[model samples]
Structures are given as structure tokens and as C-alpha cells.
Target chain A: MDRSAIIEQLTEIMIDVFDLDDLEYRDDLSAADVEEWDSLSNIRFMVAVEKAFGFRLSNSEIESLDNVGEMVDLIQQKLA
Target chain B: MTDVLTLPWLLPAPADFRARVRALKSAETVKAADVTTLAAYGLDLSQLGSLGKIVDARREELRAEGRLRPVLLGVAATHTVDLVAEALPATALRHGLLVDTVQTDYGQLAQAVLDPSSSLAAAKPDFVLLALDAASLGLARPQFEAAAAHEAVQSALDYVASLRDGVRTNIGAGVVLHTLATPAESLFGSYDARVPGSVRWLIARFNQRLTEEVVGDSDLLLDVAALAETVGLARWHDPLRWHDAKIPCALDAVPLYADHVARLLASARGLARKCLVLDLDNTLWGGIIGDDGVDGIKLGQGSAKGEAHLAVQSLALDLRRRGVILAVCSKNEEAAALIPFREHDEMVLKEDHISVFVANWTDKATNLKAIAQALNIGTDALVFLDDNPAERERVRQELPEVAVPEVGDEPSDYVRLLSLAGYFEAVAFNDEDRKRADMYQANAQRASALQKVGNLDEYLASLDMECTIAPFDDLGRARIAQLINKSNQFNLTTRRYTEADVAAIQSDPNKFTMQVRLVDRFGDNGMISVVIFDRGLDSWHCDTWLMSCRVLGRRVEEAVLDHVAAAAKAAGATRLTGEYIPTPKNVLVEKHFEKLGFVQTCERDGGGTTWALELADYAAPALPMDIRTTIAFAA
Candidate 1:
């Protein structure tokens, strides 16, 4: 997946998952930006992303995917 | 049977909200069988006058009852907004409320919300329903950016944030703002896109923005979207193409929408807090082991009913995954209870997932309390689910705080009933939740070690009782407060405090306080006890001393006694003394000090016993205890 496309997909997922009305994806945007991105939902988000991208995430991979930039990077690696 | 307290809808509420609330009142039936019928209409403003009249009637009826206090009171304001404002003073005087509407002045609204007279302050409706007009946010084909309207929205948002903090501080007050941002669909033109006009579109936009702004702040948002969906689905599902006139009244849809609103409210409260205290018998699976034999008991994937039971177990396991602690409170022969837990392959929640397992024939409430004490949570957090209603009712009456969901007579709806309760919703997950069961299991192992200790002092010392006492740190504060709330027998002075309270104590230099985490070869007993003190002008007074009952009789008490004695001696105090206030329970420890060699200092008339131990003569017993120490010096 193109990094931008992956970012777009992740943004859409975040919006849907958090029920954000009009979410604008920024590199600094993280789980902290959204209230509904609770610990349980975070795990669910990871599960959903894994299914969507067709790749399993390790503990390190999940931990490292904290910020939007890191998420985009991981997505690029998976797609590559 | 009419819930005269509920605000009558603008459209005549279909006869159903009354019927549904009535059913809830009566034990005759469960939640409405077909709530789909209730979900069929939009908020019809034409009936606003009628709704006002009905509300007046209901308020009068409640006033007549004298005892009926409305959890939430609803009022409709017509074009006469000033009259509505004027009525608030008298309304607050009589019914105790100021209206919760979209404010013309955010400051005034905040003051009103903070004031004791505000409806938000008095009634504390979990959410304030605000009726807004469409023009406020510019409803169009493309949604306008909320940031553009930030100036006006910011004031409301800030006021809301202020109210949020205020509500937390005050009792019977936690006001959440819910905006109904729309006029009427028919008046707004084809703005509805599918339904009718801008009203519907405005409602959707407002709901969307309001939801965003509220974020984690609001308990729940009552949106008109679900009701619109219900109406749309109803219109489409109708076989005969009917005109608007032939369609059901929007009022008829009120009950359905109301129920959806109620469920949403319940969900927002965030899952019925329920530590699942399960009974092991035919309850978890099938068969009475003493009678049917272990192998004969129905279980496994092959048996359909067994599968259903296993499905229930699996649901419980899933609930545990979501942070619900699964505990076993069964009245069975201990060996029989263990058969399935230890031997059965299909058991989803293994022995370890059970945070507290009491297989003895003890009264379940006692066992349940033991579990709550062990877990260091309130009994109210427990939801006792058993196939037997008798068992359920027993616990319900004894531990009334525990939410006992009524499991139906039929086997099939067991899973369905459990799901409806939603007893396992968690805001966050933690390592503590996952390891809770293992901790309890380890405590059980620690219990077995207690049996081997030769004498009280020897046992306390032999297991190498290590006390990790430090000034109450952030990590241990929650567990400490939890100990205060849950600890009973070993608790000298049950001084219940919250996390904030503990932090306040830590900042105060006059008070000497520390929590002790007892650990041994068996396992880690996390924050097992706490003690506090005040060095009085004449003497050093031991304020509070509490240890976990699980770690009691293991010379944990010896550590506490020794610590307090040494502290008193070090302070150059003449004597050390403590007080014990009697409750229905804690009678077990009424004679605790007499056993510990404390002399009676003063005995008040019909109050509780008080004791004092002289620092000069107090000899710290040289017990055969394998002990480690971590005590802090007085500041």
C-alpha cells in the first residue's frame, strides 16, 4: 500500500472506531487526540488493521506503531 | 401504571413507553418483546404544546404522590423562551430544577448548572437535552467545519467542561449537554436528502458535532439518527406504499426511541460493573456430580445443551477478557466442584481464570464477600449469575449492592440474558486485570502455607514474611484505598479513603502513614495492609491499622504491632493507644488487642473498646519469623 493511502485508510479507521465526526489526519495525531481510543478499542483497532492489511503484528510492531508516522512506516513495510 | 414522571413526548408518546416502563415496574414480563414498533418516528415539533401540557400533568401527578422524585425531569420551551426562563425560579423552588437547554449565554448556563437550584444540579439528568435550531451550524450538502463555529461553540464547550468538574465535586449533580439541533423537517426543504428537509440533516450534523465536542466528557448523547433509521426502515419495510397520513404517528415512535435512549444511557454508564461470581454445578455445564457422576454430567461440544452451557462459559471467559473478574462461589462437595475445573477439557475459564473459588457449602453471600475482599473491590461490583433463582435472591437480599441479573427459567436464553446485562464493559485494560486470577490462585497457595506454620508467631516469621512499607506511592494508592474499603477482620480502624484522600494524607507532614505489601515463598500479596499515625503532644496515637484477612494469622499482625510499638518508643511517647468502633461485622476483631497484650485504657458507654500498650514495657516478641523489613523514619 502507498504510504499516503495507508495513512488515509488508518485515518478512516480511527474516525470510524472513535466515532470522530470530521477527523483530519496529522502526523502527530495519536490515541491521545481521541477520547474513545481507549485501551480496549486500541487492541480492537490493531486487530482490525491486521485483518485489513493482511499481516500479523508482533508485540514490538504494535508498540512501535504509536504515532501516525510510525503506523504509516509499518504499513509501508507490510505492503513492501 | 403510566410512568407519570417521564416527560411526555411532543407527539403523544405512543401508549408503549408507558407500557414498557409499566412492564419494568411489574415482574410479569421482561424488556419489551418487540421494541421495533417503538422506533418509528422523528421528533414532531407540532405537538410541542401538547407535550408541555402532558409534562405539566405528570409533574402534578408526581407532586400528588409526594414521594415520587424524578431521576430526570423534561420541559419543552415554545417560542416563549423568556417565560420558560422566568418559570425556572419557581420551578427550582418547587421541583428543584433549572432547564437544560442550548444557552443564549454560556456563563449564565454555567452559573445556573453550578447553582443548587439548576435542574442540572438537582436532578442531575445524566445528559441535558438541548433543542437547537438549524441555522446555528449552517447545514448544507457538505458538512461545515466545526472549527469555523469555534467562537460560539468554544463558550458552550468551556461551560460544559466547568460543569463537568463542578458535578464531580458536588453530590446529586453531573450535567452532560445533549443538543437536539434542528427545527422541523418539513419547514427546512429537501435538506433531509432522503427523508424530507434540513431538519433531519441538521439533526444528523448537530449530533455528529455534538458527539465530537463532548468526546469523553458526556455520559451519553441522545441522537435522532437511530429513530430516523427506524422510521426509514419502517417506511421501506411497509409492503403497501402508504402516504404520510397513513403512516404511524411520529408519537408512536417515541417509546421505541425512548427505549433506545435508555439502553444508550445504560451503555454510557459503561457496562453494568459485575464481577461474575459463578456457581459450579449443572449451572456451568450439566449434572449433579454426586448423583449423575462426573463423566455423566452434560458438557463438551457434542451435546447441544451442553454446547449452550459451554457457550455461557465461553461468554464468561470473553467477559474476563474485557476485565470482568470470574470467581467461583459454588455450594457443592469440594471434590465434585474440582472435577470439572481440574479434569474437564472443554472448560473455557480454567482454574486460573477464577479470581476467588469457594467450593464449600458456606452461605454464598459470605463466600461472595470473601471473594470481594480477596479481590479488593466492592461487593456492588459483583453480578451473581446462577441458574437457581433461590441462590440469586439469597445473595441479592444479603449483598443488595451486588447486581444479580435475572436468569430466565429457560436454558436457551441464558447467553442472551447475560449479553443484555453487558456486565463487562471496561474503559481501559491493565496488566492487573489479566493477572488478577493468578494472584488469587497464588493467595490460595499462600493459604496452604499458613497451615504449616507451627505457631502464630513462628508462622508469621517462618514463611520469611517480608514487609515492603513505603510512603503511599501513586502505584499503590488505589490498592490501599481498595484495602480500606474491602478489608474487614484485620482492619483495626476502618478509615475508608479514596485515592485523592491517600494523596492528601501523604502531603500532610503531621500524619505518618505507610502501606505494607506482604510477600512470602507462596506468592506476592500486593499491598496487603496499611497503617497511619499522629504524634500527639502527650502520646503517639495509632490512627489506622489494617491488614488483608488473606494474610492474617501469618504474623502479618505481628509486623504491624512491632512497627507501631517501635514507632511509639522512638517518638519518646509515654504510651501507644488505638480505638475500635463496632459494626455488624468486625466483631471477629473486637478482642484482637486483648490477644495482642494491649491493656484496656478506656471503655466508653456502649460505644467501642479502646486499648493502650505502654512503650516502656512493650517487648517486641522475638518470634521465629523469617522476616524482612522496609520501614520509613518519621518526618
Candidate 2:
């Protein structure tokens, strides 16, 4: 799947995770952007991302990724 | 396809039963209707969290209706419980909220369980849930010496014991301990599982110690690791989740965790199921037994379906060994139905493993009721398993009290489905449990013999029954504690005591504890009765007097009282006081004092009639047969 397609799926998962219908997702968005997004919830969020995009990220790799854009970049590298 | 929301499959059980099933399958948000239905089974943690908002609303609604019973739960976790907090509340709400827990902070479990003046002590919880992991307990790492590992295990156990004593002394809420989930991705690899000082070996050793500890201590133990194994270790413990949230278990396993804890609480509340009623044909074997003769039945290792049937049989046998009565209810000719068990070479289940087997062309609902009648257990205590959907559905519709988990088309998933039902969640396993099937089988044999003998008293004498009454010993403690918790129908005063409570009562100079073991020509009944009497100056008060329902009408109760009166007289007590406590289940014991010829004494304020018997004037209850007695250990 292309980056845009992956992002669309990721956005849907993000919406489901936060339990908000109108919750929007952007590449530049980070944990600060979402209200319920915290360290505790990041595991669930990253798990959803891995499922949506089909790639695994280490704990350190997840900690390193600062924003959704960076996650998309990482996904691109892994998928490629 | 029709809308799943229509819930056409819900039938008579609940209007939204399908919704709960759907919730487990796909996260469509947990509805209020889903709450009661979901409580019946487990869900993955992710599925549970999906319904958080609905659970929150449901909680408030429950509180408004005054249904939520407040339980102060002292929680100490190795992880951040943001997800557990979200998941467990809904699970609790669904299971009728025996404990509407007000939990303490994370990382404060030691303080909650140990210190009297801890914030948790101030909360004054009804129970304490200590989710201690091996890492936090300092036993996860590979030790240099096996002795060092042994020391750590001993220290952890001692620490827990001290905490329990502290809680009893200070907070008064009993502790509930969890067996550590063997950390996925072992440090020592294969060596961990084999080497004595390795992490896996030490962890296993620690679990053994915990088992021993729970048998001695009063606190309940939850085997999260065993539950984790059933859920699959990879699925149960997610490393990423652990690393990020400090959550030891996988987020998806929250429902299972909650479910197991809920069942334990239910067992503590005396709601555990007693019997498993199985079906033949596809349930017990791979195909129809009538169509496929004994020689042709698919029950051997050649086929996957056959192996699955064998697995179910293995599990059923295991349950029977754990005091869960096994019975068969099948809609086929008796000969054809039993042919697999009797003659089939590959069948793991034999006719002897089952306490009750009814095989005929009768409808299963009727057969199940008959089975319960023969076994002297309530229909509610029975769990019916059948491979046929129609049979399962019919049982569910007719006997709404009976648990009917659908055995799907896939044979591989058979045992998994049954295990998830949690019908036989064990609080304690003792020698009695292992020999329960044999005892019941002997009861059946006695019932059959009772028909042949003309004289009732003569028949009793023919059995050559001998009972040995002795003071409670350490070897009999677990079974004694179990009987106190489980023996309900014949129980007077219905006093439920844990192992620790039983120990205290046994050791107290002011109280007397004695247990009776019966051995007839058939077999040993194995510690069938317990009596705890409170010794007074001139009068002895009977606090707990109970006999197993299996031994009813065998004149054991009469023998017990006669022995107790003799003992009381020898101890220079003139009067023996007994109370008749009325419960919904114990009506058989209501007129017990009257039958035993005890004089009418002052009735206790606790809704029970108190009666007294003068020891010197009391005559030994006459028996047609010669009585044998051994009272070696005095209380």
C-alpha cells in the first residue's frame, strides 16, 4: 500500500482509538495533538499503527518517533 | 444479510445476547444491553476498552439504581493501569458487581497489604488485589546459586505472609495474590526452563510456594500465568505494551483477567457450578456413534477431529478429578451411546470416569433434570455441553439456568470453548477432590444395593460402615477448610471459613475442631464431616456442624452427635448447645435438633433456633450394627 493509503487506515484506527468520530489525523500531529494520547495510551496507539501499516516498531523506535509524520516516514522505510 | 442489531439469535436468554457476541468479535462499542450478556464470558482487553464510555454510563446507572455494592480493593501493580482501570470496571459491572471496587494507587500494593496506617488502610477495602510480578519481587533474574533462588522464594513468601498478618491486624480486608505470569521472552532461553537457578525454574518454584501458601493462608490466589497460557502467551503478554505502559499483560487479555477474577469472587460467594453434563456423538467422538460402529468411530490419533474429542475427554476427566461431577446425557440407544466409552480402543474417557450416564432417545432437557436428581444437586449446578446447535439451543431455552456454550463446527476449538466457560474454577484441591468421582460412584452402587435389601436397618449393617472421628490435623486442614466453604445443604449455621480461619479455630484453646472419616465396604468417604464446638465452663456450644450431602441418610450425623456428647461428658461438660441455622439450601437441617432429642433452649437472635442436650442424660444413638471408634487426637 502507498503512504496515503496507509495514512488513511491509520487515521481511521486513530479515530477508533480516541473514540471520536470527527477526530482528524495529520502527518505532523503528535501525542500533544490528541487529548487522550499519553505514554500509557501510546502502546495501544502504536499497536494500531503497526496493524494498519503492517510493520513492527521496537520500544526505542516508538520512543524515538516524535510525530505522526516521522511514524509515516518509518513505515515507508520498513515497507520499502 | 439481516442487520446484526436485530439480534434474532438472542432467543429467550436476553434480547441483546448477540450484541455481546458481536462485541467480542468486532469492537462495535459495548451497549448497556451487552453488559449482562458480556459478563457471562471473557473478552479481549481491546474489546473491553472499546466499551469504556458505555461502562461508565452503566456504572452511574447502576449506582443510581443502588445496585453497586462498594468493595474497597487495595491494588498494587508493576505497571500503569490506565488501560486496566478502563477495562476492569466494565467487566465488574457486567458480573453483577459483587465488588464495586474503590482501588488504591499503582506501585503502592505493599503498603496497601502491609501497613495498618497506609492510605489503603484508611480506604478500608473489603479485599486486597496484589498484582506482584517476578521482576518487582526480585526473582526474575537468573541467580548464581539454586540456594540463593530458594532464599528469594522463601523471602517473597514470608513477606506475603507478614503482609497478610499485617492486613488482618491493621486493615482487616483479606489479601488476594496473583501467580506471576512467566515473562515472555525468557532471559536464559532453554536453560531458564531447565536449570534450577534459572529464571523459569525459579518462577515455577515460586508458583509452587504460592500454591502451598494459599493452602495455609486465607488469601485467595489467582493464576494469571495459567490464564495467560490458556489465552496464548504471545497474545496475553505484549512486550511493547509492557515497555510503554508497564502493563505486564497484553491489553487484549483484560477481559480474560477480569473474567477469572470475577469467577473467583463468584466461587467465594458460593455460586460455582458443580456438574458437567456431556453429550455423545460428535461431542465425545468425531462422528455419530450409531452410524459409525464402535470399530468405525473416529476417536483415535489419525484425525484432527478425533484428537479434539480426545482433548475434550481429557479435560472432562481432569474436571472430574477436581470434584466437578461428570455425567452424560445423550439422545441415542444406551448400548450405542456407551459403546464408544466401553469398547472403543482410542477413547480417553471410560464409563467409570462418569458419575452419572443416561443414554437413551429421550430429550436431553429431561435427561439433564434426571441426572441432577440422581446426583442430588440442583439443576443450576449442572453445565450441559453438546455439539449439536439445536440440542444446545434447546437446553438453553428449556433449562435457562443451565450454561450452554455452543460447540461450533470446528473440532480443534472444542476444549478451548469449554475452558473459557469457567464452570470448575478451583479454590482448593485436596485428596477429597481427587477421590470425589470414586465416592460418587460408590454412592450410586449403594443406591443400587439399597433397592435389593428388604430391611433398611439390615442393609445399613450389611454395608459394614466404620467412621473414625479424630481432631483436625494439618493433613486434613485443606479439605476441612474446603468443606466449610462448600458443604451448604447439610450445613448448620452455614459458617464459611478459610484455611487460615480454620487453623485459628483448631488451635484456639477455647474451641474444639474435629473431623470424621467414613469407610464402608464400598470405599473410603474421606473426611465427610466437620464439627467446631465452642467450649464453655459447664456448656459447650456447637458453632459449625456439617456433613457432606453425599453421606446423608447414612446415620453419620447421629454417630457424630453421640461421639461429641461422649467427648463433652469426658471433658466434664454437662450441657451441649446446638443451633439450627436456616438458609435457602439447608432446610433438611431445620428440624435436626428435634430429631436428635435435644431440649428446646433459647433461640439465638441470628434467625436460628438454639437447642441444648444434657451430656450425662444423653444416650448413645443406637445402631443395629457394631460401631467402631478411634478418638486418638483430642481437641
Candidate 3:
């Protein structure tokens, strides 16, 4: 529910959806940094996150998120 | 056969599912068998997508290794079909098909069908799916005037008919059309049905008209509106996702949608399950029939629990009425199992309804195999429904091909779970389908009588069978097509044909077609055999020879061969040629031509053999049945 916890959970989701060995969480890490993080997998990642956090990201919210930091910040805001 | 892998009935959470996927990925070499086993479990949308990627990769590898040939499915949709396409292969695995999909560009369905150079045309798929939704087809637009709404419906249907004709004439591929799922939100709420211009009313009318058009045709229809109604329409249509990504339905419901499509495709391939093998005790009735006597069993209309058990019986009876064969497999004493079916007043399934009943102290896996053998169907065609998880797990472990739904403890949930599994999905229904269960029951009766007679000759003679052999006509065309697709065992060539194909054959001047029906003192076995022969100057080639296995060991083949040889000889043919094509299910007829006195003439690659019988020296075999024919043939 906290920022660090949200970051950790988001990292796990990305690792699974992207089929990565491990991910180094950074403020600017985005789809451009991963080959497998395409549009389809991005949708999968959003679905997984919503199922995990028990909150839905609006269509616009899902489209506008820029990076890992932005997604973590959005989760923090939704939780608040 | 390899060992059956145990899997969970319920789908796991995302984390656990990912863990399992990771383990599969870490294997030294991913096997298609392992992937198929994993796919047998219930999967959600995310898991379906993930597993579909694995299936696609494995499909390529298998194709490259010369071990797999997939059915090419061409998809054309007005919305984004990427997710549905991705989930299709995984869902298709459950129905015994390796599907490789080629999708047309978004909103290019018309162009793809019209243009010869499009990728969809180039793919030359076995089946083309026109996945149109209400919004994409303009059916979602409401018109205040009834004339405008009717015109809109007419135009939409006309456009679809054009596409269907184009697909058939240009690509020569089967077309799969879908009904539009009407929008959930209505403008006038409960009064929407009163307004012919309302979106709901217009779409419903369109769906009814669509069903009327496609019902007797050779093409397949996926009832998307009915599917949406099954799961709440509100859950089926995701407006947010549709507006954002053009997703046709909710992402979570994609697996279910793909499953329905897969089942329809499987039915066309003659792979739909035919029998429902149910357990006694907790499955059919509430209390253990053995421990609780016939009077103590909770069934019928007394208590809620009693009615719940009765509902299960009612469902089984209904399935039987629609031509699905029913069998009972239990571990209790045979007498105890029969008491409820015979003595209980509230029982919906009676002793006469079941074709094969096995009650012994054997393990369920072995008993299920026996049931399949007794019914003359493959183990894969059996759907085992039991209330005990342990028994379900054992059957899953032993006979992985048999469908075992993770039916929870509640008897009330059994019908819903089994219904949603779509194990008995059918594409066509005829009078023959309604009487199929009765025919199987008659076969069971003949089996019991054979045991009493003690001699094959005496048994055959005592039954006093009579058959009417005639040329294929319009009246028997539907049943002929159904038998051609449904008969896997005792089928010489295992060739599948649609009703349209059969109709074309019927009118061909150079071909001879026969539809054989047998009836004895027991019951009428309605059109049990279909044969087609190609006429030649000196030889008549048997293009297809298939008989229902329920009539096996009764010298039906011998009688048919006698009639065919006489008919061919009478028609100025000097010889008869037959071919045996081997398939996993058709081994029952591997030596068919040889047994019928045809000498092996040539051996083909891939275990196929050709045989020829000299009609100049053909001797009619002694047949038990009194055969009558519309065609003139020397007896």
C-alpha cells in the first residue's frame, strides 16, 4: 500500500508479464527499456496490477502512465 | 501412453500461475505434451495469453520438426483481435486442434474478403471467421423510425451474405459467422422491447433472422449474443476497453469467448464429446444410495437438497434427449445402484435411459475406460462428473483425455459447471440426433441377448434383422453428413463431408451413393451406414465406407459388401477397389478390405494400403439380415 510496497509489487508484475529474470526499479524505466514490454504485454501488466491491488486503472489513466515511477505514484495516489 | 499429470480444477492467482509458467519455461526442452496438459486446466485471460504464446512457439517448432500440421484459421474482425487471437491456440488445445491463426487488419474484413491479394486470401485458411460486433456493423445505432431500423437490418444481412459467398467462391473455405451481442444499456429500460427502433430490439431481431438463415446451412454460427447472455451482458461488454483499444469484449472474458469458438471448430472436426459418464452416490442423488436405502436417498421435490439432486438427474435426462449418450460408473454394488434408478419415484434417470451401467469395486479410471469401450466411443469422448474430488483427481490422473470438471461439493452447481464446459457442443441437430441415445440403448440390449444366445450365428439369426439400402436422397442427406463426420471407428477412409458436399455427390452422374438403415425386433437403428462409390469403365472405386460401430460384429459390413459387389457387377464393372487409410481412431477398420475378400494390390506410404476385388469372381457372402433395395442388384 505504501510507495516502496507498490514499487515492489509493480516490479514483480513487470517481471512476470515481460518474462524478465529480474528488474532494477528506476524512476524513468519504461516500455522502451524492455523488448517484451509491447502494447499487448502492457495491457496484461495493467490487468495484473489491477487484480493485485483491487483497484481499476481508468482507460485514460492506463494510457497516460509514462514510466515505472509514474505508475508507482499513481498507485500511491489511488491508495490514498 | 505417458502418465497423466494432475492439475487443479480451479485456476490459480496470477502469482501462482506465473510461477508455474516460469517452471515450464525453465525446463530443458518444452514439450507440446506438457503444454497441452497444462492447458487442460481452467485458465483465465492472462494465463490463456501467456500459454498461447508458448503454444504458438511450440507449434512452429513442431511444424519445423515435421511432427505437427495445424489447422489454419483466418480471423477478420472490426475491432482489435490480437488478444482473442493470442488466446485461441491455447483454448484450441483442449479440443484436440493445433490452430495457427492469420488475422486481417483492423476494420478491413470487407477488403480482405473482396481483394484476392489480401493476406487472408493468401493464407487459404480451412475456416474464415467473420467476427463482427453490433457497433462495428452499425446495428448498435438506434433509429426512431421502424422502417429505417428494418432497412438497416436488411442491409447488414445482405452485406454478410455477400461476404459468405465471396469466401466460398473465391477462397473455397468454410465460413464462420457470429451473431451480434446487443448493447447492455437500453434507452427505454424495460420498454425497449416495445420500440422496434431500439438498439436491443433491432439487434435481437437481427440475431433471430441470422439464426433462421444459418440453421440448416453448412456454415457454422457462433451465437455471441447467447454467450453474452450466459455470462451477464454487462460483464461481457467492456465499454471502456472497447473505446480505448477496440477490444470486442471484456479482456477477462476473452478465454471464454475463445473457448466457444474452439468448441465449434472441434465439433466441425468431429471431436465434440458424445457421452456424459456420471457417478452415483453424491453425484446423482444427495445421500449415498448404498448407505442410505432407496427410501432414505435425498432426491425429488421434498427438501432443497433433494431438489438439487433431482436437478442433476433432470440435466442428464435432458442431455440424453438431445442425443448425448449417458452411462453410470459407480463403486457400489450393482444392485444398490439399480435400486434408485428402478424403485425411486423421484428419479428422473431410469434404468432404461443408461446405455451402459458399470457398478463394481474397481477404480474409476478403469471403469471409465470400460464404459467407453462398452459404448464403442473413445475415452476422450467421455465427460466424467463426480462429486468427490478424490475420484475426480484419480480419473484426471489416469485418463487425462476424459474431461473431468472440478465440480465442487454442491450438487446444485454440477449442472452449471458441466453446461459451461461445453463438452457436448453441437453444430447440427436432426431427427437422427434425437434418436441416437435410443439406438445406443438398443445396441446394449442386443449385447445382452447375444450373451444369452451363446453363438454368433444363432444370435444374428434370432434377432431377425432387416435393412433398407437405397441411394442417398434429400430426406437422408443430413443424417448422412452427420455419420460421415461422426464415425471415426469402423470408417474405411475417415473422410468428412458437409451436407452441401453430400448434396453435390447426390446429383453427380458418375457417382453411386447408398444410405443403409437397419431395424430389428429390438429397435430401429436409423441410417447406420453410408457408402459412396466412383464409377469407372472397368472398376468401381469405393471412395467412402463407414458404418456405426454400434452395429459392429453383426456382419453389417459383410452384408454391405455383398450388396455393393452385386450392384457394381450389375452395372458392368469388372472389379471393385477399396482403400484403407489409417488413423488413430480408425484402426478398428484397418483390415476392412482384406476381411471382405479384397486382395492387396498396392502399399502406399504412411501405412495406407489399397486393395482390389475382381467382380468377375465375386461370391456373395451369407448374410443374416433380409436386405431390401431400391436399386436393382442381383441377389
- Candidate 3 local lDDT, residue B519: 88
Candidate 1 per-residue lDDT, tens place, B1-635, comes to 11211222111345444333233333332211111112211112112222222334345443433221223422211111322322222222111121222332332444444566654456544344332323323432333444444334444455445555554454233333445423322443564445422345445545665667663432335455544453454432221111211222232243333333333433333223547888777678877766776678888788787887888788888877765678888888878788887887777768878877788988999998998877666675687878787887787568755766566455556676565434453323445456555566676666666677646656555566566666666776656655665465566766655444677787777777778776676667667778888777557777788776656666666666777667667766778778786653466778887888888888756578888877787788765444454545555
Q: Look at candidate 1 and give me any clashing residue pairs.
A: B38-B256, B98-B119, B192-B197, B461-B625, B461-B626, B464-B626
For candidate 2, lDDT tens digit of each residue in A26-70? Answer: 778988888877766677777767766677778788878889888
For candidate 3, lDDT tens digit of each residue in B125-166? 988998877876678889889899999888888888888887
Candidate 2 docking quality: incorrect, acceptable, medium or high: acceptable
Candidate 3 residue B385 Cα shift, in angstroms, is 1.1
Predicted model with the maximum TM-score: 3
lDDT (C-alpha) at residue B209 in model 3: 87
- How many clashes does each candidate structure show, in the order listed? 6, 2, 0
> Worst ten-residue run, lDDT, model 1 chain B?
B1-10
- DockQ of every candidate structure: 0.01, 0.23, 0.49
Model 2, C-alpha of B167: deviation from truth (Å): 4.7
Q: Global CA lDDT of candidate 1, please?
A: 0.55
Could you say which candidate leads in DockQ? Answer: 3
Tens digits of per-residue lDDT for model 2, B1-635:
11111111222234443344445445444333445445444343444565545555455554444333333455656666556666665556443453445555766666666677788788776666667677777887878687897888888777766766777777766667778777666766777677776777777888888877543445778887787776667677787666656778765566557767766765654557888999888888878888978877778687887888889899888888787889999888888887777777888888988889899888889999999889877786788888789998788668766777655677667677677657676666667778888888998999989999967888898889888787777778878877887676888988877566777887888887778888899998898899999988899999999988887788888888887787778788899998987775788898888788888787778577989988867888676434456544276
Error of 1 at B245 (Å): 26
lDDT of each: 0.55, 0.72, 0.83
Candidate 1, residue B286: the lDDT equals 76
